[model samples]
Target: MDDSTVDRLAAELYQVSQTGKPVAHLTKRYPDITIDDAYAIQLAGRKLREADGRKGVGAKIGLTSVVMQQLFNVYEPDYGYIMDDMVVMENEPVKMSEHFVPRVEAEIAFLLKKPLEGPGISVADVLRATEGIMPCLEIIDTRYEAGTMKVEDSIADIASIGKVVLGGALTSAKEIDLRYTGLVFEKNGEIISTAAGAAVLGHPAASVAWLANKLASYGVSLRKGDLIISGSLIAACSVEAGDAVRATFDRLGSVSARFK
Candidate 1:
């Protein structure tokens, strides 16, 4: 596709997201589309964001759970850049008006102390690149019309990530085996979900590793202090006005958010 074709597709996808329209048949509608070309559309959306002065500060890895992959029929995980504007404090109550459409997820976030770039980075490499990790909640909000979305459409729409909330004490990656770390999610004081670190692509660090090398193909890289939302540890929970949600981790700590 030409540059104009890429931009048109990008704008259409962003509008589809913002309008909450079902974009399932976009490929059929736009015959020039391929996952690679769809990604070109995705980048065009980010370029629009950059044109608006937003700067990417981190990355989010999705499809870490085999269950989610099985449900989606995708063998590989998808990723999206997290701009600085998306990061928020967990202690603060999240205003409902801040989002168009949203859902919350429990995750362990890492702030790298060194750059992570890869064509062949390993889980061990991710652990070594660690500065510290913390508990977090990522808000995945979609703007697709009809509210239905495909994985590629979501990836093109910044993985449907709207905001991320981080808190709890930070711990060194060496302090604990993230694979064995456990967490239980609660909403209004009731346990709603449970997960172990191993659930995320077998280990949370591997998600970051996968992201590093994935972005390397485009010449993008992760830097020190980049806030990576490793992947959801618990099944995502629906949020509505006045609902309170929290996730307590086995070692990392706890983070929470309240709608409205």
Candidate 2:
């Protein structure tokens, strides 16, 4: 797509997000669009948010699991920026009326203490960067109309990220075997899904390393104090109004949210 078209699509997506109105899939209308173009659109949307005073807090990785890859028919993971306004406190109520097609997933979040810019970042490097890790729940919402989105479309929609809730348990990464860390998601007192940190591209830290390397290609770097939410441990579950969602991690405690 041309620059003008990319800008127009980015504006349309931003408008859709603000209005809670769904739009047609960009890939469905522009089949020739490439992943690079999709990322450009994402950046455009990020620029809009920044201009509107929504600071970039961190980033979220998507499609990191084999299950998600197969479901989307994509072989690699994608990522998106996380804005300050997207952070919700644990046990807080998220107004469903403010989102479109919202869903939730359980994951781990990395709070960085040092800058990480990578062409070849390793999981060990990610852990060594210091700070701590927290169990997290990512709320995903898409501006694209359901059932018509492609990988490119998802990328342009900022990987469909909406909000995030961070758990209170903050532990050093060096203290735990994150690969074996386990998670269980519950909705209204019923166990809905279960997974382990290994589900996230083999290890949760590996996902952060991947993000560091991937962002380097776009001239971006993970900075100190940045809160990076690694890929989901389990598949996302659809959420509705009046629902209570909770995720319990074996050693990381639990985080919860109420939809209203």
Query: Which of the numbered candidates is closest to the native, going by highest TM-score?
Result: 2
* Ten-residue stretch with the least lDDT total in model 1: 20-29
Q: How many clashes in each candidate?
A: 9, 0
Candidate 2 ranges with C-alpha deviation above 4 Å: none
lDDT of 2: 0.91
Superposition TM-score, candidate 2 onto the true structure: 0.97
lDDT of 1 by residue, 42-160 (tens): 78988877887989888898888988887767888888888877888876778767666678899999889899888898989988988889999999876555534566666666777
Q: Candidate 2 on 1-260: residue-level lDDT in tens? A: 78999899999999986687889999888989999999999999999999999999999999998878888898889999999999998867898877988999999999999999998999999999959999898999888777767889999999989899899888888889998998889999999998889999999999999999989988988999999999999878998999998999988889999999
Best by lDDT: 2
Candidate 1 all-Cα RMSD = 2.4
lDDT of 2 at 133: 93
